[model samples]
Target: MASCTNWAAHKLVHAWLLAALLVTLLTLSPSLSAPACGVLATVEHPVEAGRPLRLLVVGDWGRKGRYNQSRVAQQMGKVAEAMNNIDFVVSTGDNFLDDGLASVDDRAFHESFVDVYTAESLRKQWYLVLGNHDYRGDVLAQIDPALRSIDSRFFCMRSFVVKAGTVDFFFVDTTPFQLKYWTDPGEDHYDWREVAPREAYIEHLLETRRYNYLDTLGIRLNSGSATELTWKVAVGHHTMRSVSAHGDTQELLQLLLPVLKDNGVDLYINGHDHCLEHISSRDSPIQYLTSGAGSKAWRGIFQPNEDKLEFFYDGQGFMSLEVDAGLAHAVFYDIDGQALHNRSLSKSNRQHVDQAPSLVSQE
Candidate 1:
């Protein structure tokens, strides 16, 4: 009888200890508990004068809070907090999932964007562009100000320019450049309701008159001369160069590369390959960066373009950038908030030599 009583007491003590541990863990910061939102990672860097722009770039993240989306958001929150003064977030399209939001009031909007990225640091303005997936749904709703009424952080347009300090960011609408979307949508349903009859849109984009001679001036030159344009960055949803399964975008290369080259653009940031990558061209000053690993990732889909490819990772993550007057610093972090790659470039290092460039080569 005494042995039975002692065993019962021991079991009770064990249960109490287990419960205490659980409570302690739950009480800690959400990030410390596990991969979750609302947790802030502590990072401190002294702000240098003349290099005031700081931004976070993410893409293809809308998965309705699943597929590591929440975890990635959590890490972004932490990074944002640590790296203070993040001016804004660049959404490289595919902001919505599979088919995109059905309407301005679509449930997916809240489920994927609002509820998923509920971190204090993520409250900044979100400059967004449409992805090919976004075309599969109501594309107008995304660019409408109605979304801003829902959450003031949302900002979307077909193409526009934003000037922050000495730098000029050119946001380009790239989904229309793909000929396949026009010729063969296949099993996918693309809601071309707003800008249907693909040929017209492409013609207008390519036409110097309809495009306001913008194409002739070159998108990069729009930023002005070196004295005025310290940094020129081009952001788009499609990639002109990549080594992933999607490979290189032929349309973008033909239409966009010349403009980038002519204008002496510093970096071309895109998110279509669904991974993180950096490709440095020996022939041009422009560096290619891919930050499509917002949530879903293509495991082992790398094709390894060894000539220009610098860094490539097939996983879920995002990229952070800090631009100063003389230097541009880039870092890629995984879902766990771990830094994967870091590279910096001096303003004097900007190359503009003309040569037929190869795509991202494998390491």
Candidate 2:
């Protein structure tokens, strides 16, 4: 009877110890207990005072060089070579295809990403977000810091900010905002480990507190008396306004668009429809750009929305942006290394002056 009593006491002690350990972990890492959207990691990419910040944006790409992904990459390399000093590349999302990485050791990472974008100019840092397809596989594997060991250029997170000179790029995680992913995800299984109770997660991510840092940065810039023009660009995997097959993501239009408009976001860039597009907002000055044609493209999928469609190309292509203190210019390039359309916006004293987009002749 004494031995039994001692064993019971020992088991109870172990239980208490385990509970304490869990509490300690939660205390040490608040992220384990709850998502803290305000604490997103910021990556700084400095630019020279007089030079304009240049970058190439691609999405819906990773397919092991298949589906004309390699061809598009070749054109991207050519464009980067012409620019000569491309800063970095922004991958809107869907880094992997139908599903995401099965594991950190998945060969698709090398076959699709490493072996594919093989250009001297394409060796710069890559900032990426997670698409809905990414959630279908090991979501943790893609964002795992360990993957950096394989390629230092790989920098991805749930949602983060990249501050480059006058532009502050806000990369948002938009997959969780969709209701169908949780309620009607037909045979597909999404790895929503850290993002359960979607409402709280979305609320925290879109909270104004998360954007206070940008406001502070703006104040600092304005303190110099030289009327510095600050630009805010938001990137995500889902589209707010599009004329392609996927059209508009209603979830983002309702929940995320208002916050972006309120925060003075100048451009919302996304990739999901596997086509290149540009749409102008009627209510706000915000411009919507899509560069999802990194791989396969829809040939004849067109669905008009309420907004003004500036440009639309139902073929494989990518987009490039060059931003300075006053002017921001964007160009869309097709798989044949031809410029299809171009647009420019000039700002003075913090007011945007929109320029009409012109079609580039294929000659």
Candidate 3:
């Protein structure tokens, strides 16, 4: 009996050691390691044949339907219905206010997103990037694959690419570029799980010339045999150029801006400021568009910047982009479903032709 008991104990010890070794090997394996910054996940969104691609962009609004979040969503739904056959929605982060999701099962996710944008027309896939506010909480929870089970529309990632016909939208993770979030976080806690060693991460993401991970995206623009013009749009949570409360994210301007410009990115859409704005870059053809007026917005918080402020509105609103083979139209609508500003850009001329804000007759 004593010998049998000792044998059982030895077997148990051996099993424990084997399990520990397996876990360590799995953790150390490069295949099981965290995704490299250069490897941006790509998702293909099919655009209807012979139809223009339409998408709504909203940001900085996860306040549980408060601060006109519901209102904006309602307006979005109305606009989406009117447009008909909308492709998808692009959320510029700040999906949750104060902090991000506590976990994948956090009720706030359903309350702020699922319940708010309940329009049948607004039930398309939502591609999202991470904002500074989103990094304060459980960052992994926001991008967890499990959230899709709760709501299929919930799609968030640190950085990814959305390919739709002639357009390729490069959604970049800009929160890690900000130095203050690391050195002087004040009272806020940032979840930098996969983004430690900031220099290596950013370098891999924006590497040009040698590896040319992101820059090569432009090459594919003219690769096909069709005569359709290809468009490149860069989306992020921080502003590379702005004339609002968070006037300009210096870190992004210094690091990300050059890469975008070099890569022939036509538009840089972001939403850090709590307002809707459009600024044309002085040096490049890239247009800076902000549609952050999803929830609370600053009343009179405007600052001077070098770029041309094409339009600025300090009220709650959302923006829409309609793109076809040759032209792209962008419009900003106020809370009451009125068009505050609209612009049309042609692929041939690439000129910014501003149109007067026309009112959308209410239903």
Candidate 4:
């Protein structure tokens, strides 16, 4: 009996050792065993204890507060207050419909945004990017800080970074990256008032050292920030990969995806296809989230790819995210505030982490 007990103890020790080794290997291997993509630049936003970060994401929603936009906003308020603290809101772009804002004083601003999202909880800062529809109007007017003076909530920039707590949100101007918009308009009308001569925009992205500089900065910031590395997220108006009506944005896949992949980004959020979707690629663990169902939805207009698609809802709705040090939770809410789907990710289970022993518990 004594000999048998000793043998069992030895077997258990070996089993634990093997499990540890497997965990180490998994942590080192990039998701799908792919190479890392970009150099991460960190933005410093300290998260306070007991105060988790929360965000409301919407897109393609500017329509003079008509349709489902008002209903979505109302639900957002209820969700925000329930979450206790919502840091801010994120507009995945297409902020205006049909045509972009004509001027800083464009009444569409009030009608579409100001008047629609009247919930006191939603009065916080709104980080915005430009979409194709927005580029159809005056691009310069949308980013003008003067709009903030009129209403403190409107915050739009071509490309900027917002760091809160241990997360860095990189907002990129994806509309200008697509060449077809400039080379071929066909029947569509584009204002090009401030975004004219297209070459300048393209050159800035390809030739200039702007993005490269950010890459270096991200590396340093991520290394030195707080105790653990901060999570990185890239926000654009278009998607790198999707199974929606728009399919995939080729330009973004080629130019931007590598950067996001290399920087170990956790999520890429966008809104061009007018639907809510979640996609996960085996080649990389970066999640592609779409929340463009603010005002209108494409109903069943989607081409489903089982390999890439995780969840998809064909209706008008919005998305909410709550982030903490150990986990990130996401949920989709319909226009009537009904919870449809929810997903959660633990930090230890992240594909980019160095070790993931706790992932076993998550399973």
- What stretches of model 4 exceed 4 Å from their correct place? 1-48, 191-227, 305-307, 351-363
Model 3 clash pairs are none
Model 2 bad stretches (over 4 Å): 1-37, 199-228, 349-363
- Residue range 179-242, candidate 4, lDDT tens digits: 8887897887775553455564455446743333244335533555434546667888987777
Model 2: residue 139 alpha-carbon error in angstroms: 0.5
Give the worst 10-residue stretch by lDDT in candidate 1. Answer: 35-44
**CA displacement after TM-score superposition, residue 52 of candidate 1 (Å):** 2.2
Better of 1 and 3 by TM-score: 3
lDDT scores of the candidates, listed in order: 0.72, 0.77, 0.77, 0.71
Q: Write the per-residue lDDT of candidate 3 for residues 234-342, one digit (tens) a residue.
A: 8999988877888899987876687778766788999989899999999888899998889999668888799999999988999999888777889999888888888
Off by over 4 Å in 3: 1-39, 199-228, 354-363
What is the TM-score (0 to 1) of candidate 2? Answer: 0.82
TM-scores, in order shown?
0.79, 0.82, 0.84, 0.79
User: Against the hidden true structure, what lDDT does model 1 obtain?
Assistant: 0.72
Model 2 C-alpha lDDT per residue in residues 242-262, reported as the tens digit of each score? 988888899888777876777
Per model, how many backbone clashes are there? 12, 0, 0, 10
- Winner on TM-score between 2 and 3 is 3
